[model samples]
Target: MNEPDVAVDEALPAPRPMPHGLDPDGLTVGVEEEFLLVNARTRRVASQAPSVLAAAADRLPGLRPELTRFQLEVATATCRTAEELHRQLRTARGTLTAVAREHGLRLAATGSPVLGRVTPPPLTDHPRYEALIGQYGALADALSLCGYHVHVGMPGREYAVQVSNHLRPWLPVLLAISANSPFWDERDTGHASWRYLLWSRWPSAGPPPRFASPAHYDSAVRTLLHTGAALDAGMTYWDIRLSAVHPTIEVRVCDAPATVDEALLLALLTRALVATALAATEPAPAIPQHALRAALWRSARDGLEGMGVDAVEREVLPMRELTQRLVEHARPALEATGDLAVCTELLDAVLRRNSGAARQRRAFCRRQRLTDVVDLLTAQTAGATALT
Candidate 1:
């Protein structure tokens, strides 16, 4: 697939006609992935991120820490297309993996793992994190979890807010696609994304209400902060939200996908969804907040193995059919971005091979050891497939 035209400020030598009805100049892409560090021998959560970062300080530029010492995050610079995102994903994962291996640690890109056991490592020594530890206590401590967030550029705040509202119903399908966390605390949680469950423990986490405008969105965020439901604007942890810092709509529904392919797939589809929402002339459907919550739970519980909520119908559908519906919904934007063929191929690949959760379970069944799942995730995180 051709990379999306990323040149924003300067004119191209020759402008190509935008295909498939996408606003070629309007949409850009960025991704943030959080990964867990585990001891190489024991496959347990390792508080060695600091050491790894210190060792590779000059090598990995975007590498940084998460809430816990066991987690590390890498953010990709804004890019123009799926191809660029794929390349960035490979470089980030490969560099991080090499650095961790030097420290006798392994990097696994899943939502949550059994390695943390009863408790995760201590919080990072940041003052803001210190405040979270003091306020949220165990809720903050047990957060050895990680997620992949996709950001799609919006024209402005209004479009970002509207796109966020329109994209709500589709969030579950995306969640099911990237559901990589099935085991937690050394036991199978039976849910595809145990990370989502762990994350929702925070008062400010979950789906955001439909906003009339960007001002309404700002007001809602202020309410959460004033009531102490959130520590700050950054903690608004909606499954999807207009980003607080960047000028993009960010989707936080996915687990830290187990492979670079799956991570790029998530970013491609997310950009398509945002583009589709922006092109829509009609208002987004009004599914009740309760129904939306139920839909999210259904996606987390069944993933691609069973039925998922049909957000519009407020009922259930086989995940296979639900995924196809999503593809069809985003077809135009995918084609416009030159990602339709790759996205369709990847979607078929995911269905045929099964979700990361299913694959992890299969690995565990083969060995009857939870650490096998950890090993599998560790290996898969390192550029599972080469990008053409």
Candidate 2:
């Protein structure tokens, strides 16, 4: 297969000269998390997003509709610290869960709707989403998978693009740490993040190729748009891309986390990853396209449970060992941002409990019930229980 389009469009004004390390003001971070809304009684996905949004609008200021009616997104304002991001996510999840309950719905941060109902919920009434449904046909319906996008500030577009080139090899590592979607269509998909596998079917979705410069990245994006492969620059849904709406490198590799702490851990790791890339003298060389895709597939398939491709070494290693190396690689950045301890603790907890995929599977195994799995996810999403 040909290489996936790794184009990232410039979202900022003309670049201004700036020194590279951590930005003097510090790298800001923001998180966008999407959730599935399911009926409280039937546990079926509920197409009640509009109604839920209206009811919760006052309580949740930045709530937004997703491609499907069964999904809702909550994004936090930019923050300078992980603590702030954690607090905001907690509040957003709590408020949304409460409002959803009022409407007899449950919010699940897990990857897919738990039960096996085949008919997809209706698409949201929006021109963009409508255009997608028309263009992609059945592929559009699979867009119901939820994801977590973490935006980390970079000094400028050139810097962001440079970081992106350097960031590619590490993308699989990030994906493994955040994999939480194991079940889809009410059955274990066998892959840790079936959401990623489903989403990758998009023409523009997957790890981007290494770029020579920001101009090269922008040109590639324009080329893709001209071909109608993507509706717009925003459709360049590479695992990591320059944000079309913000001055940040958006990491879109992970499933929407099941809890606030998981979300925060992802944010911390993302910022650290970007910072480490910026400070580096050289980024990893472009892996062969085949290798890049294989690494990503392994991450989505096994998550922490299987072997992972060590893009840096170009060899596969135990996923647990690979993740530990990722933390060490980003340690300098974590320390600079005062997040080292918290990040370490959170990563440890995730490994201990296994990724969200493991926990969801365990719940089903123990009770032999999908509702029990849904219950576990809802409780975690609302922060009513710890990650374990």
Candidate 3:
């Protein structure tokens, strides 16, 4: 059944103000995690988000509808510490798990659906969404992808744009760590993140251009709007961009990870990256756009298990080496935020078990059934099982 667009309640908590005299090192961070609603029995995408969200509204007031009825999203209140974000993510995911279960559905954090239906999934009943479908046609029709976004507070929009330049080279490394969509349409797509390929169909959805200044960024967005490549500023779907509604830089590069801890790891790493970028005295390297694109493709194809392109060096290297370099790049910031130890532990765990995509493929190989992969994702989302 098609679901009506559900409005988010104002009762949701606002971004928390930084405590008095808190070290600016502790930049506020928030995350928005998108999830797919799956039928518990059939293990297929279920267009029941409106009812699931309605049932969860009073208890889990932060829940909101997404572009498609088969998906739901929740944003964390602004947080200063990883511990605080961890608690909030756990509470939200737990509540959503119970709510979805009661409504005969399961919340799966995988990037794309593992099963297929005869018809396209229904879009939420919103006029803007209808217009998007009218404008983009098939590109908008294949919009059932879920992503994990991290928003780090910035002093100003111009500074945020500058920081994004520093962030460009590391984007592929981050995507490799969080690549979670290996299966789609009941088959292994052989790519760690099929969602990335699917999402790239949008003309405005890949890596953002390196802007010389805030004016350059604005002019580029204006071009997208004038050319009808994007319906609005919100549609400037760069991998990272200044948030339209928040005083933060938003990184929208990863698939929705399978576990809350994975989400926390991404959030902490992103905050550290932003903080590191802000403190740097030297200019960021001007890596060629073609090199960066090649790096992104490698990250999406091989995830953490294979070679990755070093955009800075213009050479291919082991993903493990690139992953370590990313951690080292943000080491000072991680230490300042007291998250270095935790980040190290999480990185070790992910490497030991493999990326989410690798784990999902392993599950399918064990039983040769897509349903087993769905079960794994459902369990991981609910924190019912270790992401082993």
Candidate 4:
């Protein structure tokens, strides 16, 4: 049953004691990818999630969660190194692709397929999602709102929070680089990532300020609960924030990356970014929110082709230039982890031509029909298609 649109709130899951200090050597990376369900025959979305889940239970390992009947979330095992991260992502994709094929379905990677509508069957009966529907009601089940979540294990809660504080200012740059959602409900939304707008609506979403300390961060979360500002500490979906459960800071700005390389580039960059911030003597100075948001808008509207305003120096920088600047800026930190080469090689490709969304648009224009676009999107998500 759907909760009324009227005001009603429910208590959140209980908070537990925080974890220990950050571990520099104990590197672990985890990824949770969300996808929309689509019919194999039509390529249009079908709420065929429950049937697919049941049929493919043996295929999926322990980490898959059904967000809705048509929506699925698959997580990678905690990777101890970059190679492990790559392997886990491939395994998750392979298993999910095989299962989807068995059920005559395809998983889509785009944040919101141009043709998606929020209507879809609710597959899971879990209280967590039920509580979600009951609380937010219709607003919670937006089917097109797809995303990719990457968790970088932090040294500890305090360092995670500290990194999160510094990371918030740069979250928009990540979003700009990763903008891949160009259409909604099968029509052009005129924004590279309409999904970003949807995500920003949630109370806990968007960039957060620098927390004073890990202890201060915890106290603030507690205060949010006591004041009714948040349903729980988990709701603190700050664009960049320390995970209350995991010993990591979670970055939530990116739309689900279309290509595997895009995903890996983001993952590597995030690790380098965090290390850079943590080692710095003073907090990274904040970027002007207005300028950052405007750059984000340009990035979403035009992807890498759009020029962004430099909030720091107050000038216009070409998207390609900004991207280069980011790589150069993070060279020292990436070098620390020896992932600088990975980042440089990936950026070379992204800067040259078009992004995933751009290529998808080109394909759609080639066939001049929505069906063709669906075929393209389905292939990318299913891993049967390739741009590599």
Query: Which of the numbered candidates is closest to the native, going by highest lDDT?
Result: 3
Question: Which portions of model 3 show Cα errors greater than 4 Å?
Answer: 1-24
Clash-forming residue pairs, model 4: 21-155, 22-155, 22-156, 23-155, 114-185, 114-186, 115-185, 115-186
TM-score of each: 0.92, 0.93, 0.93, 0.86
- Encode model 2's per-residue lDDT on 1-388: one tens digit a residue: 2333442332223223448444732789898999999899888888899999999888887899888888899899999987788889989999999999999999999777787463554889989988887787888868888999989887788888877777788888888887888887878888998989998999889988677567778877877798888999989989889998888899898888888888899888888888777776744465766788899999999998789999756798999999888899898888877899999999899988888888988999997999899889999988889987
Off by over 4 Å in 2: 1-25, 116-118
Model 4: per-residue Cα lDDT over 328-357, one tens digit each: 766887776777887888777776646767
lDDT of 1 by residue, 190-264 (tens): 999888878887888887776666777888888789898889999999988888888888999899888888898
lDDT on C-alpha atoms for all candidate structures: 0.83, 0.84, 0.87, 0.68
lDDT of 1: 0.83
Off by over 4 Å in 1: 1-26, 118-120, 384-388
Model 3: ten consecutive residues of lowest lDDT: 5-14
